[model samples]
Target: MSIPATESDTATRALEVLRRLTARDDATFHEGQLEAISALVDEHRRALVVQRTGWGKSAVYFIATSLLRAQGAGPTLLVSPLIALMRDQVAAAERAGVRAVAINSANAHEWDDVRARLAADDVDVLLVSPERLTNPRFREEQLPELRQRTGLLVVDEAHCISDWGHDFRPDYRRLADLVDSMPEGVPVLATTATANARVVTDVAEQLGGDVLTLRGSLARTSLRLGCLTLPTSRERLGWLLDHLTDLPGSGIIYTLTVSAAEDTARLLAEAGHAVSAYTGRTDPDERVRLEEALKTNELKALVATSALGMGFDKPDLGFVVHLGAPSSPVAYYQQVGRAGRATESADVLLLPGHEDADIWHYFATASMPSPSKAAAVLGALGTEPLSTTALETRVDIRRTPLELLLKVLDVDGSVRRVQGGWVATGQPWEYDEERYERIAAAREAEQEAMLAYERGGTCRMELLQRQLDDPTAEPCGRCDVCAGPWYPTEARADSVAAATGALDRVGVPVEPRAQWPQGADRLGVDVRGKIPPGERPETGRVVARLTDLGWGGPLRELFAPGVPDGPVSDELLTASARSLRDWPWAERPVGVVVMPSVSRPQLVTSLAEGIARLGRLPLLGRLDLADGAPDQTSGGNSAYRLAGVWGRFAVGPELAASVAETTGPLLLVDDLVDSRWTLTVAARELRLAGADAVLPFALAAVG
Candidate 1:
């Protein structure tokens, strides 16, 4: 006798229970959330939930899973990146009388149990990391069995898949492939607290599904953001002690290095503030203990690296103080997100200093063995693939250095390897050219966004909203800038007066121009007279003239007597090649000629100094100069000055345009033109706009 459809109708009953839960006062649902849920139910397709931080995103998945389980549809599978989050969710599920289990490295035999339960259809939900999910044996043998009983695939911290995202994880790219191999068209529900429009698109694309975006307000009215420029580390500690000593509840202090974290924790503890340090180096048990202590408010503050915030949730955190600048806004946002989880007043303090930024830049631009190392490793492996350890021995580099090199190469698509081995995939590096270009644009956009936030005379919330693609978002009245109603009026009057006075002193009308002779002259061009001594006569435009006349090679050859005729020492050649190749120049010849003039050690330092100074001048609002010849002319160390200006400009535009294209709408503000970044953004935007290129402009001199 066949069972009747109604007899096995768990799904229908689950839907009813969901409706009832929504009706209860304690389970309030926003209209956007309701609509999002409705869409998911109606489409019967996988949906990605892209919501801002603190928007009750977790509830959507929890309720969805509960409803599905009640209907006997199948268990929900949550692929989380953080183990701590998995434990928390499991505990919460148990408290709610829902059956849940987690499978990770800690419980080595847990996978066997999980697989058995999945086969028997006895489990409600299973939580595991992407790494665990992608295990070859698990995928080949157990996954197929599990997939048949899996209803939903929830990817937490979904932004990690986006190349433009701050925390891009290689493993996440394979998640879409895993989901695709599932038996049923299991709906994927990805959730994240942060991600602008571009990030949203990236998540959808990565998951191979449509997005059900429920972007709640980013405005945290109860939270305050402030930057304190401390001159020394001691001062930063003193400031933290003064503020945190009497504060109630818990707090987190973010440091740049593991050593710094340990040191800071020690300092705080010695000063009688209960503090503990957490870093990647911490054992799993210690980390869990610290997290539990933080949750219980037993620890007043936890000094940590970026590792501490991923999966841990403490609703009562009252403060998030950054001991140093995070590498990017994404990181800064994540750290600050730990605070203000509840509807209470909180504060995020950024102890401003250049040390952290410098350190990050050092790592970002540090020298590494060329792509040849990857090639050599692949060659050594022959037709066979080697494990990471085996490959390290063959390459003769330390595991850490080798891993970093391989990761960079992998990201650059300069090499490919099997998941378990160092053997070349035989396929040429399938570079995601478009994706790489998009990331470059996004970085430029982010740089611009950063500068805009630092310099804009507007409400911080407004700037943030605009950066995040909420163009019409209203000013949040709670920010320092918005709180002072009288300041804007005074600021506007002062700005107008300054503008009027400058215009009078200059005695030149402000107007956009295709080419301004006077502006060109100030830039070292012989606009209205014969070429100056030591200048190219043909172009009569200084650096441009040099490039146009092909005099750069002759000039460089004249300056450096020991310059080699053929291949030099490997190190020297590599240095020379990188200098010639990597310098940010509008024209390649200019970079090639000028790179040798400044020593490699001094280049970045001088550039940083110049950028800092240039950032302050109003008239020089974003200059995009071509990298000039290194040899100085009568116009004052052309390469040094131009490099300084260009470097500053380069950071904003290059980073902004690259990032914006991948991550979406960004507001860039800088003192110099970021030509490289701008060129890329402009190219994409121009294509979208039915154009080829945006005409370059000198914001100050031309206007």
Candidate 2:
């Protein structure tokens, strides 16, 4: 099998591959699929295809790889973002008799074999994640040769390359360098289903010269769209409980956060529904199992987060129900597009909530790098590479944000990650204020558009299409606004009661910090390595986390900024008491001690006194803030946080005398816990002043 040697011959070969891939004897290319394939196999040109989901984007690449391989071109190199996408693509390629292999975090054990296959020309297509592009061994040794001889380069979910898009990834931004390094006559293809006109233009500019762009209508006639405004999370859960079984078939229930997904899945399962939760925290092996279960109709729904978003293939996912509105219409469109790809019609519904805006604000700000923080990170690095743990001691950013900042710096050429860790590249870097501002403004506009969709004045499907700048936007006549809701909106009274009960049940373990953060001694703190067993606090309990589905609402209200300081509410007090009663501690505390609070003095005092009175324990005096100690806000890396509170709390004469008299562990109470550093510092002070053991209790834990 050599090169076809003619365009007609190439098309004939590609059609055969497509039929094999689809397992259909009469299969043919969709509207623009063959043209894109021809551009790659015949003309060897760059192509961008922005079609709806399930429009055979993968087929274009798989067929092109087959033709190119027959023509004696080098194996196709594919850059994918998610593991699930790679897994599914590998399976699909095998059906066409194209040998495909992948190298990613989840399959590290097979990397050697995969590399051997590539070396022996046993692989027709080689897939690697965008993050792997920067890996030391692969980037330095293999990628250079592969770039020179590559037959075709494909970028799946190409919208991620542009920062203007909703889900911009720093790793994807590095693809421009890879594109520039490709040899002459090597074809390139970029495909995505969620890019709007703005994103399309940005991606095109990055893909470089004379790319063929093929975009089709974004409308999905098989989707029946609708919106139900449910003000509370409990009500939304009740609605699902009442109507989940009534929906067409096995489908997805999307959530805005991991805790919401877990909580929803638990409540539904308790009601005798076969369901499970899927999120970023879920184990990779278990994710594969759950995805299979849904495909086989073994489970009713998998309440999942955006981690399950892109490249998951199920032809007949009967419905998609959002537990809460996503931050933007573009993102919402991408998620709901997962349904109705093969079915005649699939249900799509949005249950909008008031707390959605707050969650949106948190996520939007968390990803963007701060100028001051970036500078701090850069200043901490030098000729020697420092691991993230060591670097955390010198910078004020938290671990997650610190890692994100480093990736952005890497993309900007200000730093480089090597074998040991990261080092400064000494390259000049400037924060793009104007670009970030424009992106922020665009996001605000998208959020407003999403709100308008929820308000329901126009055809639901048309509104989503217009948001994507689809030229074929029009009424689908399948939405609630086009043709009244095809499903019910009411939840039975008993269902609501069940949901309320689930939400009200509370108590989460607050695991004690075992080891001190690395390089803490550099911050003028003497601690390093693990804390001594005697000085460490016991595993404690919180009434709930601020992110919990049930008690989160009240906890958020109580800690919201600008709220007037006040005594503990009776409702929270009762819940706290209940939590304490149910805690399975090895030893009960003989007394209670309070940590001084500047922000909520009245609330902290009241909570401590009430707990002491209820439990018949003495209320020991509170620890005092050292003279001129600055107030600590809940943010920053562990070492920086520890530095702020080092020697900040002092057990005064009265508290010291009371501690000396007590015989058992003392209960340490605080209004809220973020990093748990404050509680650690206060507990250390109490232990040294002569308490036997300390147990931490908090009103709420920050997610």
Off by over 4 Å in 2: 1-7
Candidate 2, residues 1-703, lDDT tens digits: the string is 1223254877788888988998998887788888898899889999999999888899999999999999999999999989998999999999999999999999999999998988898999999999999887888899998887799999999999999778889989999888888998899999999999999999999999999999988888899999998768778889999999998899999999898899999999999999999999999999999999999999989999999889578889999999888999999999998999999989999998888888888888788888998989889999898999889888887888888889999999999988888999999679999988888888889889999999999999899889999999999888999999777878888998899999998788898888888788998899988988877888888999888889998999988988999999999989989989999888889999998998889999999999999999999989999965634767788888888888889999999999999999999999888888888888888889989999999899998
Residue lDDT tens for model 1, 370-489: 455556655656456567656643453445556655655644444445557645545454444575566656665665555455443777666666556554557777666666421111
Q: Whose lDDT is greatest here?
A: 2
Candidate 1 residues lying further than 4 Å off, grouped into runs, are 1-25, 209-211, 246-248, 362-370, 382-385, 401-422, 430-438, 451-456, 484-703
Model 2: C-alpha RMSD to truth? 2.3
- Candidate 2 whole-model C-alpha lDDT, 0 to 1: 0.90
What is candidate 2's TM-score against the reference?
0.97
RMSD of each: 20.4, 2.3
The true-versus-predicted C-alpha distance at residue 87 of model 2, in Å, is: 0.6
TM accuracy, model 1: 0.63
Q: Cα deviation in Å at residue 253, candidate 1? A: 0.8
